[model samples]
Target: MTRYVALGSSMAAGPGIQPRVAGSPRPAGRSARNYAHLVAAALGLDLVDVTYSGATTAHVLTDTQRGAAPQVDALDGSESLVTVTIGGNDVGYVPMLFAAGLPRPVRRIPLLGSKIRSLVNPAERYVALEEVGAALVEVGRTLRQRAPRATVLFVDYLTLLPPAGPASPLSDHDATLGRHLALELERLTAQAAATTGCGLVRAGAASRDHHGWSPDPWTTRFGWPVPRRPAPLHPNAAGMRAVADLVVAAASG
Candidate 1:
């Protein structure tokens, strides 16, 4: 049977959307419903889900929490395929941007601007992107070294802009920043894939039209709800299903 490994952050983890036991930290069940599981099941593959909530690329490379094991560990004696969805939380940029609102021209001022810019600026975001990309490359290289015959697939993040309705307070700016951030993430993903010889899967592009707050068959909310709690900005069940379909298609191809 083919063997597959999935590595990445909460999106990969499936959060509240993926059914789990009462106290289980990780999402329970196979990738059957989750994109990873869906792809693996379709291919009759053995899947090792190394995905964890709140995990960053650096954490995946180095951390040793129960749910968050090292990506390298998941690839030990790999078989046919390896898929990854990382680099979303490297510099804590997304959360920070969501908290700080959009990029206003006033934020360009030196002191306050530095503080806000640190939270909103594209340049600062790019720094985090670079770190994430480099880390992904390292993870890819290690996976290749460990699983020489496995096809390495790096999945990019989906877009989070153009929300659903009229611009709410701070929605327009946040959406704009989200668009730019999504593009930057794609660039980083492409760069890492190029360096690591991993097959690049543009999952983001697949969700572009359906992303944001608009009422679509694919998306649930706009700009992700606040409180950052159980079901915050991550994908809902429908979203996960869409993700699963795209990943299954990518894996089959």
Candidate 2:
């Protein structure tokens, strides 16, 4: 039987209200059923989930917390698969962008434009991306060292905001910024995968068509109320299933 290990942030941790197992402790409202669990089950592999909430690549590679293990320690020579989703929290970039109201068109810029111009210098963004890429490469190399035969898959971040809505005033800018940030992250992840000789899974491309009102079976809109809970930008059970399907296909192939 193949063993699989998944590493990343909250999305990998499955932060949301799930149907609680009778004896299992209920995770917080912010915790949803993430894609890793879904994929592991689909592949019938022994799953080791080492994902943490609010984790960046640096944190995953270094942090030690109860229930949240370091990505490096999860590796074993006998493991057959390793999947990683990381780098969003680095520099607190995503939250800064979103909280700065980049998700909303009007507030995004010149506020976002000015902030982007002022706070994160071009040199800084480049340097940060470089660091993120290097960390991913290290993660890949470490996984390979520990599990020489395992097929490593490195996943990029998803686009949390949907394309501009017709009714929204900031559609064009929102779309542009969202795509810009997502693409940059994708490039960094791709670079890491290339450096490490690991497989790259582009979540943005896979999810491009299904955002906002057109959410795939796996996602819900930002403000929509879910049964027994509410989650903002995370994937729901259906989304996890979709992620699982993609991962299983990749692993099986």
Candidate 3:
């Protein structure tokens, strides 16, 4: 079988998903059914998924998290495919989104209070956009150099908020602002892909109608559960399958 490598953040690692893959870094929340796994299964590829829940671009290129090696370190010249879904954490997208969509009471909970407070009022809407874009470009360059023959792809983050107007929990102001930020990040992803000559899977655009509040949501909405949900405000199992199909189509295209 061909070798396939998956690298990214929680958006890709899929925390709280069912039946986690064994031998994966538990802290990374590697799911047995993440798009990478599904893509590998569909393509009959041997997968090395090192996607971490809190990963930033640094984690993909150079840094290690929870004792796991840098994501790019998993690559070798033998791999045939590599997919990367990252950058939201670098710009504090998901973190800030969670903070913005929460009730004041939930935001005040000690565990979430400090974290939310720290991000709720950043000087800018999205943090470090230029730097993150540069890092993403570097990630592409490194992947190409490391596995020259492999087909590298960049998968953008999925849609989390509704199109416009106030959905529950999010104020109208927040709803509009979130859309702008999501668009900015999606643009950044496309920019990175073009700059690095990497294939892109427009998961964000494809899920526009499937926001958490949509009739059929591919993402989980914000909720503070006692045990905490597997992937709050992130992609769900259906989303994973959708992404896997996208990956397969892109790979086979």
Candidate 4:
């Protein structure tokens, strides 16, 4: 049997979606419907999905959490395909988004506002970008050494907001920060892919038209209620399918 592994953060884990991977002691929050499983089924391969919500590059390279092994350890140089969606958490992207969406009462507090501003600060954002960049480089180098024959592909994050600027519902400050981070994350991923010789899947570009601001959004928003589940700031079913198409193509071709 060919070893096909999936690694990364919540985006790769597919939180809030069901028939989750059962029997795991850890709260993996993995969805069987995630792009990894979808792509594995499309390619008829057994998927060893080790993706967990809130995982960082450090978690991928080393065992940052108990019970779960380092993501790279899942690769034993025998994988035929490996897909990773990471780096966003390394840069504090999700926390920034959630903080930006804080209620008015919380934002009214001086200390809270100041902390949020620090996260939105350009200098701070750039510092995180640099850190994630270095981590990506190490990630690329490690994967090449471990899974030399596997078709390693870095699946970038999906589009969360509009390209022009953030839409309504998001505060002016939050909107600005959201848009900036969205574009910067993609750029960082591309740079890593180029440096590592790993195949790049333009999941973000493919998701542009399907952004949460689009007429038909592929991702959920801050407080929107979807039937039975709420995967806010994460990709919806259609979005996952679209990303699966990109991955399948890359793995097959």
Candidate 5:
């Protein structure tokens, strides 16, 4: 079987998805049903999934996360395919959403509360777009160097907010800001793929109409995990399968 290595954050890891990958680090939230596994099954590839939850661009390119080595270290020049989905954490997407949901008084608590408060403070500066784009370009180039035979592709995050709607649980203000951030991430990710001559799986573009509030949601909205509620602010199982289809198409094309 051809070797395929997967890298990125929770968007690729699929936290709370059933049946965790055996021997995989629990902290990484390596779901057996994540898009990489689905794509691997569909394409009959030997998969090396090193995706982790809460990963930033730094985690992917250079920094260790939760005692694990940098995600890129999983490569060994023998793979035929590599898929990456990162940058959300770096841009404060999840952290911002999570902070928005906390009660005002709750945000005033110590330690974790302070961190959460900092994420949503309007005065705090987000990561620059160019820096993320540059990091992604470097990721693609490094992966190509480490696995020259592989087809490296950057899979941007799935659409989390509706194009035009009142994204519930999020204030109207936060909804709009979230939408803008998502678009920016998508734009830069595409640019990064182009910069490095890597293929792109257009998950964000294709899933725009399938945002969390849509009739058929690809992603879960911010809410408690009841039977009906999906994982607050992450891709759903449907999203994972759809992403796999996108990857299959990109890789095959």
Candidate 6:
């Protein structure tokens, strides 16, 4: 039997996928519909899913949460495949990008406005990029050391917006800033993957046509309604399926 391990944050956890397991721990809101689960099912691989909702590279490498072992602990040299989509939380991209949606009046406050602007300033973005980039590099090194025979594949986050044009729910400015951040993240992830000799699944590009702006979106918009939980900027059921296909292909190849 092929041993497959899935690691990372909410993108791997599938937060809003219905029928969440009872007593499923926070951060690790593991859902059967997550791409990881779907991929495992499609490939007939034994899955050890340790994905959490808000994990950073640190959580995967050393930290533990909600009584779960560190993500790497879920790995052993016997593994045949490992898939992960991490690094976003390390740079605080999700929350900061959402800040773009602050009430119009609140965004007028000088101090707050200045802070938000600084958050996207080139220097700040570069610093964040460098920090997360280094963490991902470390992740690659550690995974190789820990799972010597495993094929490590680092997946990128899905596209949250279109290439051009303002998407609903975000001010044009915010939409532009969000796209910029996503681009930076992809660059960092690709760089790390190349450095580590790991496979890369460009989930962002694969899901580009299904961005929130699309008539048939794979991912949820910032404030789209989701039953029983706050809207997370995560892949919906369709998005999960799309990602699973990509992952399955990579693992099989």
* Cα lDDT of model 3 by residue, 146-216, tens digit: 98888889999889888776667777766676677788888988998899888999999999899899989
For candidate 5, the clash count comes to 0
lDDT of 6 by residue, 1-253 (tens): 4999999998878887865645667456677778988898898899888889889898999987776777999887899999889988877677666666556566568898777666655567658777888999889888888888998999999987878987766777767767877888899889989998898999998988998768998877777445755345778888888999998889888
Candidate 1: stretches off by over 4 Å: 21-32, 101-118, 121-123, 163-171, 217-230
Model 2 error, position 62 (Å): 2.0
RMSD of each: 4.7, 4.7, 2.2, 2.2, 2.1, 2.5
Considering TM-score, where higher is better, how would the candidates rank from best to worst? 5, 3, 4, 6, 1, 2
Clashes of each: 6, 10, 1, 0, 0, 1
- The lDDT values for all models are 0.66, 0.64, 0.84, 0.82, 0.85, 0.81
Query: Candidate 3 versus the native: TM-score?
Result: 0.92
Candidate 4 achieves a global lDDT of 0.82
Residue pairs that clash (backbone atoms under 3 angstroms), model 4: none
TM-score of each: 0.79, 0.77, 0.92, 0.91, 0.92, 0.90
Off by over 4 Å in 2: 20-32, 65-67, 91-93, 102-127, 163-175, 213-217, 220-230
Off by over 4 Å in 3: 105-115, 225-229
Error of 6 at 232 (Å): 3.4
Candidate 4 residues 48-144, lDDT tens each? 9999888999999986665788889999888899888999888878777777676756756788888877766668877888788889878877888
Check candidate 2 and list the clashing pairs. 14-32, 14-34, 15-30, 15-31, 15-32, 16-31, 16-32, 108-112, 218-238, 218-239
Using lDDT as the measure, the top candidate is: 5
As a whole number from 0 to 100, the lDDT of residue 183 in candidate 4 is 80
- The regions of model 4 sitting more than 4 angstroms off are 108-117, 224-230
lDDT of 2: 0.64
lDDT of 5: 0.85
Which residue window of length 10 is worst by lDDT in model 3? 222-231
